[model samples]
Target chain A: MAKMTLEELRKLREEKQEALEKRSIEGKDCRIIIGMGTCGIAAGAKETLSTFLSVLDEEKIKHVAITQTGCMGLCYVEPTVEVILPDMPPVIYGKVDADVARKIVKEHILGKRLVTDHMFDRPAADIIKQDGGR
Target chain B: MHIAITDYVLEVVQNAFEANSTETRVVLQETAEAFAVTVTDNGKGMSEEVMKRVLDPFSTEEGKHPHRKVGLGLSFLNQATELAGGELTLRSEVGVGTTVRFTFDPASIDTPPLGDVVSTFMTLLAHPKAGSLVIERKTETDGYALDRKELIGVLGDLEMSGNLHLLKEYIASQEAALS
Candidate 1:
């Protein structure tokens, strides 16, 4: 791969700006989630995020935004994943291997039905406090 | 330690390879004050702009390959080194190569606890043909070097799965002596 110049990087960012901006969940009925935490990366969360992006691209799914955040405090069950749907309860899933991630895309994301077993059923209030009010 | 040094080394080296490196050299030295590691690679180096943003925990460069998203590995390395009361310096020249240096204070509160070095070595040795990973551990008394190719020649055609168990045990003992 060739080294990317500042101008080239800026151009690329610009090219993707529309898609990225369109996917933000601020006022749209979109889903947003991030994998934050140290253990997540060690467990291949980077790869998981890439897989999500690829799947979303292939499926041509708009109105969904996927981004990364800092560690969510769970280490053991790394490669952790979270899912949020507009007007729906947010779901946190742990120990998310690639297979489960695909399922999340095929079922929870596209089918609009949560995968019962993998969902973290903690109270939203507790999760909010744990996330420092985010 | 929160993030094992050996694992950190492996992850960084892999990142070097992903940057399209042809040759990679790693040096680990323990001085009276700290343990230092330097990884140099002959890969497509980063530009000043990229370097400026590279250290940010959130910066990522989209690549043709979906998995080529940036910052995850490098950011982790940066955080781990800092948590260890260590410092990480990255220097790269476009079309040239890149070098990363890490210095860790052995007696700092944030210094990560060392773990099983052998497991670290075993995982690295498993990827012999990918690139060269040279690990040199220098102590006041003496030091040792583990070259991936040498390990492969010794194991010869043995299945990676079958050999992993035995190799893990052997490396553990060697790391014990080094520690």
Candidate 2:
């Protein structure tokens, strides 16, 4: 390889910046909230959250916000997650492991469907039906 | 409820983030005789009254949880440390930050296992409220330090899930290189 020139180095830097700087939370309409409370972490929430992050990256999914918060008060079914889309009421899922976390990224976020089995309480279907999330 | 030493570290450092600290530092040091960690944060500290009974499981910050009346993280950790012939020291001031240091014999049966520190650190990074996290790890013969801000400047965004796997791998590799 030849010695890199200044112009070439600048171009490369900008390219890398543009690619890596794709993270923008503003105007994001989708959210993946994971429970990171003591209970949640003890139950392997870290692994689940990691799976979600990697899957989202692999899928190149945008307009989504992934965050972790303290206890959600559902310690019995820890590693809980809440998925909130623009037109749907928040859906809480419990006992989410790595597999379910991947399914969430694909089946729920990409396929636009619900992972019903892992859902905390049947998807709040009644609330969605009442107003279609308004 | 903590199965690993990392669990306790995670549970305690989270308070610093929740307090809206702009910066937090965690130091983990270990040797054959003992293991210790110190977490210092430039966040809102508690008053003397709160500090007096901070270990009381039944007491919690006011209005933190409507239905819950207990904060078990510190209380449980204090109990475990005490049983393991360890000590948990907490120093805080209203305007100043808080520094919490705990130490225990690494060989004690009551001491929890040292779980995946990398995973715990990554979990801390994943927190939305985690501002600038600095981690310094030191063993008897090895040492390393990581700064979230520096990594972000190099890797673009930590929240970008795409970069997390790579970051995790990098951190894991760095730790593996240590003694």
Best by lDDT, which number? 2
**Residue A7 in model 1: shift from native, Å?**
54
- For model 1 chain B, give the 10-residue run with minimal summed lDDT: B154-163
For every prediction, compared with the true complex, DockQ reads 0.01, 0.06
lDDT of 2 by residue, B33-100 (tens): 88999999999998999998889999999887688989999999999899888899999988788999
Q: Which stretches of candidate 2 lie over 4 Å from their true place?
A: A1-134
What are the fnat scores of the candidates, in the order listed?
0.00, 0.00
> Ten-residue segment with the worst summed lDDT in candidate 2 chain B?
B161-170
With a 3 Å backbone cut-off (N, CA, C), the pairs that clash in candidate 1 are A36-A70, A36-A71, A37-A71, B1-B113
lDDT of 1 at B73: 66
Instruction: Give the clash count for model 1.
Output: 4
